[model samples]
Target: MNFERRNLSDDQLLDLYKRLLKPRLIEEKMLILIRQGKVSKWFSGIGQEAISCGITAVLGKDEYILPMHRNLGVFTGRDIPLYRLFSQWQGKAAGFTKGRDRSFHFGTQEYKIIGMISHLGPQMGVADGIALANKLKKNGKVTAVFTGEGATSEGDFHEALNIAAVWDLPVLFIIENNGYGLSTPTNEQYRCENLADKGVGYGMEAHILDGNNILEIYNELSEIVESMRTNPRPVLIEFKTFRMRGHEEASGTKYVPQELMDMWAEKDPVDNFRRYLLKQNILRQDKDDQWREEIRKEIDDNLLIANTEADIKATYEQEVGDVYAPYDFEEIKPGSETENIRFVDAISQGLRQSFERHENLVIMGQDIAEYGGAFKITDGFVDLFGKDRIKNTPICESAVVSAGMGLSINGYKSIVEMQFADFVSTGFNPIVNYLAKVHYRWGENADVVVRMPCGGGTQAGPFHSQTNEAWFTKTPGLKVVYPAFPYDAKGLLTASINDPNPVMFFEHKLLYRSIYQDVPTNYYTLPLGQAAVLREGKDVTIVAFGAAVHWALETLDKNPEISADLIDLRTLQPLDKDTVYKSIKKTNKVIILQEDSLFGGIASDIAAMITEDCFEYLDGPVRRVASLDTPIPFTKALEDQYLAKGRFEETLKELVAY
Candidate 1:
């Protein structure tokens, strides 16, 4: 584990030769298919096997490995069956993704390997979160991530490294600077002499090594692995190498100079390692000939079997059911009742009750630790559950969300607070493409809860006061929950925490204190996507959610002449179309009320659904009462005008008169 030079035994040298040759042999066969126009394309790791195999050589079988596109060496070194790998690239059912996904973007959970993300930076943050879980469990396993030089420019790179350094996470960042970000030269990409120096700015140590030499990579990573097992600090190392071929099979090496290419080909990792072994008398010429023949035969046999495997049927394609996690939770009956529980207190108590029930629950956000969160809803949680259970993250919204995803996939449920709903735009990639679709892609569970404190009435301007539920409501593969009262907030949150899918819990800022009700002290769970009929009337039906539920009640109370039924849609994605249709049948007049702006918001979706499902039942057109299409203002007077709370009253009167 020391940095000093050490001699390798004959057996160890032979092992390195095999690992180095495995990827090279497989890629050569794949390119032949590409040239024949059989295989689609390939991104070969021809000269970089030393770096990929070197990192995996030191990893424990139980430790997690997150790999990028050009890391077939990890698969070959890890001894993943060649037939499975071939079937995947061939788009056969025997593939890891059942032929639904193409390319090397697939992995087995049993092997502790995760597939690559196209937008690769967020995976680094996920690696940090997985290491956090290992630290909490007191398991001495380190997480390693592989990415290209160009990826370091992303903001997630800085956010991930800073958190790992400050939290002392056991994560190894392996950067392969192969002189190009797909045709863009290294000099044009970054001004810094070494990409490894970016780690120092984040308060972590870094090392640079010759990636073309397998011995150098294997030596330094072994030391880094041993040091991180007990001490657990993030370490970064840049593996300098060259891409021998074009970026992919179709793209020729026109941009790369012939002189540089020839120079790098002379020092190719696999060929160099083979020569070193030959000179050391480790492998005889006759034995070397047999080794190459055996590897070539294995590739041919696997490729034949993989091509014959069954393709996925169209009827069995991924659907809405596959998007969310498979779950079944019976409603818990409340054993005790409590009085005057504020909305915020109910949320805190609800989370506390979950900790007592489930052991894998952890809450995380920006200021949720000793300072007890921005709203103090999580006050005293750090002392009660400890910092490991209640984590305080840096002001990085995207990292925090993706980190929760990493934890969730590794068998932990993370409750992530967005601080404000309006800020979710900054983390859209991970939330929409990653967290939302992870289940559908590979059947991975994203069992994380995003607690979004949303809506206006606090005079918090557009940055903090905006209602953005419509954005998430439109996205598939996620459940959107916005509760009205303390009773519903506590009940719905409990159900959300128990849900197998990722649940978005929206808490209107105005309801935190202004709304209080008698909530049960004991735990209970309400059904998600079910509507609650606050008042039953025959004249008209007003469907609402979040703070709009309260406004609906106020409107009905102020105008006794307008007899209407107020229905609170507790969950938005699985909107209670059955309830809306039933109410519309009797009332014959409908109105949808929401806090979000008018154009292309939740109200628009509901109105469209009503017209499509129960179009003939309505006596009047579907009306909507919502805030005008503008950002919420700061001043209370202007905000009140912007919110237009009185419109529900006027709309209800006109509908009743109709």
Candidate 2:
């Protein structure tokens, strides 16, 4: 589509030039600061300033902006204080992240600018989520998400685009084609002729703009933003710009060709805009020089202020300590009464209780609202709590998790669902980058709970039935919980919702319909990092979680002589080492049981921990009972043998005999 070129007024042209120049100065100053040891590192938005500034000029100030690392120009144009930016670079307490985040990861909720996540394409999904929220709230605000051409190659980018286009959300995706992804050039990264053309695959409008030309960038984006305000459809704008500097301060441009560098330098966005302003007589030589001097002085002053700010240090002591909002534990009498309740009903009751207590709690996932989730864990929630609290999201896993992170960061308790646990692979980037690292990286709490139905049972094949909790337990900052019984599931899920950090709540699909112990209808929570001792014995400690927990219990019932203490590890991250030690001390033996594959499973970690912490207490060698290292088979007989459940019983009996 051809963009109409309207003659810009002299004043308007000068304003565009001024906007571009500010970012240019900031980039230049940041580079100097790195050399001078004032800042640790910096990402330069040198040749791409026009595209960054142009998008901000068109987008409403109240609208949300989820920018990538190299979009300093966009934040500057949005009036984010330079001092705060400098402070973040200096790792000072006054920084946007309170000295927790790196310079490029700055964010301010008050400015309607969500933080810039360092991960490549996950932020694109987050931007779509913000737009979804705006659409739901009828806030009439657009979301402008920015990313590099290399990011388009990521699965999250496609996921975000697909959902945004399908929903027709008011989201403007800006793809900055800066020629290269670090050392890899565009040709090697993607085969598409133009990045904007990829939007056609999603059935969305796409535009290509001369990113070096500030007027062209501004006019095209302005029209798109205006259209989105009314029609509220997703649009993709590919900015054909170039990165004049290396990817990060640490990266040297020796790999970049001198000829290509020279070519891009000649098309510098700041210089191009300045020349346009001078040609139009909108900015005289004297006024331009004076404005440059003033901006330079302002930056210098901000740098000085940032350097003087206090340093923010994160200590391991604080890391283990509780960081979430404190809640007074209500003194509700414990019930000895046992009433059989369906696992799904227990989940619904637990969620209803938590939502009733915590007004800020929100639930979102595919078919979670009307259909009440694929497993019906959220059945009748929409009818009970209304659509606002129980939101049905488009089929976008990345967007679902990213939006949960966004909502959690904004002081809301968010529970994101993946229809099946296997689909979590689609949202892995956000889970690893944003959810797992947000706490330690930014010193900000990400109180989000991600629920997925996992474990293999019944006739569901390899694709449908695979326990992937091990993949997440390996990630730091995320608390992985797999509750065996309905009561523990309800209690642990409630605790996860109230916790400060992100949690991966795994529910075994096989247990959803199974009748288990009675769950209280009243408010209840099981403390994280605490394990339940289901059965007390002296033969061995059978440590298990989720579906394996039930198997261990059954094995204990079958082999009464093989007295073993069953420790259900409710939360994996903060493994209840004390309980495990106690069990080991009592039984003088240890056996880790799990349904996941033996390779790198939670059992291996638990075995290592027992060896390290309770090795001397052990009477015999520590053993593990886990599934064989193979994909889940489709047939029931094959799957039963593959899961290694019988091995668990044999291992327990052997431990008692030994």
Candidate 3:
């Protein structure tokens, strides 16, 4: 062993040996349990324990670490209680995720450890957000995130690296080149010579290390992380190693040749490190045996406790209520003074007020800093809060949004603005899978407000003009707010930011400069899951949101005799069922309007809910007024023909007559 033990004390060297042995022993024990059907499947870090153990051995406890499934050493090295970790594997109620998920798919706040979601690359971006918070707070803390060679092919990998580099966030991206991603080889994953070389493209400093060498990894990373804490920059370090076992116990290593497996086995991290420790006289043979026996006893004791723990029961109501963190919504007393502002200005006012209230609030998106976003919604924001609070991120929607989740993890609220609602598809996975499920999966509050400038009628074509609120309305653990007038827009956005849950605040692009209303200058909040009745009548109830509410207002204005109660659905996810049902009972008829295409739109859900609950209080069947089922066209004439405005007036008359 050519590796020198430089700064580490003799005691620290023995501790490192113990760290390496713990995960390897735990993996061996779990594999037996997996085959016995006493525990679920496991991702083995049998050979690559050196990377996780060495990194955590040097990493600061206050700094966060987002570990991949294979990085079991991170949990054990952090001194996370072995009994709870075993319970997590056994799907017991006492686990971190409360048996909501299996394996390392959980985040524990107490340990400052965030485990990976199945999508390996998104966590890199989330680490960026935590680093951003550290930088903003000037805490001199850095975040470390892990990924594999296979996940390097994911767009999120490139996006996260670029964003971290551009922002100069203190994030250490450690890529484990473990030979294969599932069954695919490294040659099949990427054409690059080394994963570290790809980091150079982002102008980040990169390095390659002997992953099996625990002494070298610990010494090198200790220096790198210490420097990063003060300087605050992103670095990529690729640890070249091999996965000795299959990806999981179930997936056998059929694709890997016997020659390759035999070759890597010779350089196994645990055995080699133990040999080096004894050779250097840093650890005696008897002492090493004593430590190994102690580790085995601890594992057995924890396993016994976990085996006796109760399994999580499938209680429908409890599971349903666990989806969102409880939020109290109270109506603010209205101030008399008001100013007439365009819908866009109202949104800006709300954001500015939020910034004033929350000192740690951050707003980030593409071109949102100097350019004031795609629309001029944030025209002078840079001058007010400076660049640190108002960040202009690269066009990596997935990474930036995931970063917002990371920021929320560290007690900083972030607003991620998608250039257009249609562009959210690029970031759909992080929003729907990670951010939307974080609270339910592990009880983490994703305090992020995604500002999506949506809705058609501006002739921006399909990619730019989309009313995609329905995409998230059906998703659990998300608060969707789409307002029609300037007043509702201001209040609801403020409310959305303050809400503990993840919020999707949709702003209609067409209504940016078009509609003007007397919005309150004072910072006020309208309760989420509550409907506002703009106009009341006895004939019928017209339900609408966003730009569709304007169409409903126009239809009622055109035919004064058509007495109807117009309802604006301020929030979509927590639909104001009480208000909608009350209106339906009074009028005995309803027309749900939306700018989205007719098929699979939110209007359908509202109509169905009305029919199910208020079936008896119906003079006629529920009606829907929505756009034609086609991609929003670019031409003005075509766009006009496609919108619901053409059919709204006729539909209202028909429902009123019925």
Candidate 4:
């Protein structure tokens, strides 16, 4: 696999030409199809195929590549069936995504290719995750992720580079500096003299190359990738190239000065490579013409077959069902062994148990290693499990979450912790858009649990204390779990880890050390999407979760004369609707409680569901008792006044009397 420019045989040189020419032919036909209204929009790599084909040329079969929209050569170079790829582009059921996504937005696990989302930069983090798995497994596999010059501006890009550098993961951060990000010129994108220069600041090895020269790109990547397989460190390479066409076919290159377009056109990768092969006495003109004709015929024949494939509507039910992985809701009974511990200790025990039981399970977060964690839940975990499984991360939520997604797809279980629940906003795109939608889009499982220490009561103000469960519950492919007690926390956290879908495990900071319960010492799991009816009564049904469940318990204790049914919803997404409905049937009245602000909280959605489904069983309106729609205050007085716990008793009294 060692590649030397002078040692390359005539056949090897011809193979490189064919690889470069295939994508060129495909792009030309695709642009014509777009004009004829037979195809959708296209991001043409008309002049920039060398970077894709060159890097892929030297890649090992087990190594992974995360390609951007413009890098169509990565797909064709991997020898993916042209017919199925055409089907994917045409939104057919035979496509990789089952037509859920279009163009290069889909990934096929079978190909070792992780596709890019529209956001571009997050895939950089995903590459780190895949490389992290390779490092952990002691496998020599490497990962290369592609991006445009413009995407380097993203915090995700910086974060990903820093993490990869710190961990010394075997990742190739390739930037195709096409001189423009859409319409913005490269000079305007950053002030740096070269994109490769940014890599030096991160203390990573950096290289710059003439991207149009196919042989140069191939030689450089071959040596770098080979070295990475043995020595395993991240390297950033900037391929100096230009986008010959508009960003896409529709956005005509009118913004470009004709002079610039003509300049790059003369340096076209495919054309120059073809001419170079001729001058080297390797490929005759007739052979080159024959190869181009054969490629066009291959494309035309496959496109015809793809056009005849089933439409997306033919697989409507399957597409809808794939929004979440198939899951069983069976509840497991706890073993005889038990221990009296706080909620925080229960979480630590659950994590320890998971690590002991599952060899692939790993946890990553900021200061979770020797520092334990902000909450000390992972204290002493490094000593028990070692630093490999218990990883300390940079203050980069986006990359950390993306790494979790990468690991889950690569046959590993990952747990990512947000320092505080509020900090998850920085990583929200990958959690909601990428991880949540990955299963639905491509039938790939994202078996990662994001541990969020959420909720108010510590007077930590707006940034530190916020209940954001509604943010993920509404996202289709995610599972949401908010446990109330130590027993449920351990059980549900274990259950969340075992689930094949992405689960958001929210542990209320207030309940961390405040609640003490006898939890099972052995590993056990409670059913997710099932409510726990802590107390049963006939007058009213009080639905709550997280710390709000404690508020309901306290309120019910104070009103001994009032008969109330307290339902603790352990999981929020698959929502135990049947349990809530059954409780409503008996009680004939309902009240939803939450620590989040009232307007856009989960309580509003639950209240609406009750009104819609339990209208006939209701004796009165379904009321919602939640915090006021305002930022959490720093002072204890205003904080208590703004939280739902302050008014829970009075609201319960009014609802029961009504």
lDDT tens digits, residue span 168-224, model 3? 999999999999999999888788788899988999999999999999999999999
lDDT by residue (tens digit), candidate 2, 529-573? 788888887778888888888888777787677777888888887
Superior by lDDT: candidate 1 or candidate 4: 4
- Global lDDT scores for all candidate models: 0.85, 0.80, 0.91, 0.90
* Candidate 1 minimal-lDDT segment of 10 residues: 1-10
- The full ranking of all candidates by lDDT, starting with the best, is 3, 4, 1, 2
Give lDDT for model 2.
0.80
Query: Could you report the Cα RMSD, in angstroms, for every candidate shown?
Result: 2.0, 3.6, 1.2, 1.8
Which residue pairs collide, candidate 2? none
Span of 10 residues, lowest total lDDT, candidate 4: 1-10
The model with the greatest lDDT is: 3
Predicted structure 2, TM vs. truth? 0.88
- Residue 629 CA displacement from its true place in model 3, Å: 0.8
